[model samples]
Target: MTFTLATWNINSVRLREELVCKLMTEEAPDVICLQECKSPVEKIPVERFQALGYTHMVARGQKGYNGVAILSRLPITDAGGRDFVQMGHARHVAARLDNGVTIHNFYIPAGGDEPDREVNEKFGQKLDFLTEMRDLFHADKPQRSILVGDLNIAPREDDVWDHKKLLKVVSHTPIEVEHLVETQGAGGWVDVTRADIPDGRLYSWWSYRAKEWDEADKGRRLDHIWATSDIASAGHGSRVLRAARGWTQPSDHAPVFATFDL
Candidate 1:
């Protein structure tokens, strides 16, 4: 089976429900994993999505806060979720496709303004979350699985607009990068986006803070798509829907896409 998947941090599902519908109506990815849904699972406006043919959903959500959800046109069964670091945030959710492929969607904590864990509690939680993720993947050694979402860390130099300038920044900090790299190594996961579009300044998130986000072009590759080594080679057509950032009442993050043939 061949399926196209997309990962996006929608910021708030209810706030940007129209944007979701627009994406479904236009691009029509087989599966869409959304992070930062910021609504209870029951209030995700599933009827709107179901009307668009994305009838299958597995989600973990909270009121006015972090949430993760997987919506698909293809059949999918809820594979469960995890409360990494016991943060009590609705941050992770998983589903299994009919082809025996599991999809993990995560909305990692944004590790506040200060990168120092000593000064920032959120920073500590973020590190702990990554550590738990690393340990989990190392023990299980995932196979034929894909992980996608706003991981909240841009590990590579080219993943940000100006790597040097952003090194001390939250998403581009060295310690965060190291933790993210360790987690990826643990799972032996392949970055499908980088694999397909190597050697470029690619970004999936442009801060709403920018007055003219497009011309200023200050962005980070916070959103990611990863597949276990076993089926990594089958992933292709990776791209960022950059224009979505300009949509009406848009989310700061854009959708990242990859197609896998299994």
Candidate 2:
């Protein structure tokens, strides 16, 4: 079976309902994972998405904060979810496809402006969340699993527009990058996006603060698509739909996509 999957930090799914549907209508990914939904699951406006053939959904949502959801055209069953760091946030969810592939959707904390945990509680929470993920993967290794979401950290130097200039920034800081790499290693996950693209300054998110996000081109690869090494080779054709960021009242992030022939 062949399926295509995409991940995006939708910011507020309710506010961007039209954009979501637009993506579904244009891209038609077999499955799409969304983060930062900022709405209760019941209020997710899934009817429209369902109408687009995304009849299956597995989500964890909160009132106006961190939330994650996986919408699939193919049948899927809820596997589970987690509240990493015990922050009481709806940050994670999982679903199992009929083809036996498991998909994990996560919205890791953005860590705040300050990189120092001692000075910022949010930064500390982000670190703790990543630690828990690493430990969890170590305890229970995953296979035939694909993990996607706005992981919040840009691990590779090339992931940021200017790695050296952003090294001190919260997302590109060495410490945060280390934590993310550790988690990926623990899970034996292959970065499917990088594996396919291989090189270049790739980015999935551009700050809304930018006067002209495209011309300035200051961005980071905060979102990711990862698969367990066992199925890594099956993944290919990874790309970011950069045009989505230019959509009307668009999310700061563009969707990242990968196709897998299983």
Tell me the lDDT of candidate 2: 0.96
Query: What digit string (tens of lDDT, one per residue) describes model 2 on residues 1-262?
Result: 9999999999999999999999999999999999999999999999999999999999998999989999999999999998788889999999999889999999999999999999999999999999999999999999999999999999998999998899999999999989999999999999999999989999999999996999999999999999999999999999999999999999999999999998
lDDT of all the models against the reference? 0.96, 0.96
Model 2 Cα shift for residue 105 (angstroms): 0.3
Count the clashes in each prediction. Answer: 0, 0
Worst 10 residues of 2 by lDDT: 82-91
Off by over 4 Å in 1: none
Clashing pairs in 2: none
Give the alpha carbon lDDT tens digit for every residue of 1-262 in model 1: 9999999999999999999999999999999999999999999999999999999999999999999999999999999999999878999999999999999999999999999999999999999999999999999999889999999999999999999999999999999999999999999999999999999899999988997999999999999999999999999999999999999999999999999999
**Model 1, poorest ten-residue lDDT window?**
202-211
Clashing pairs in 1: none
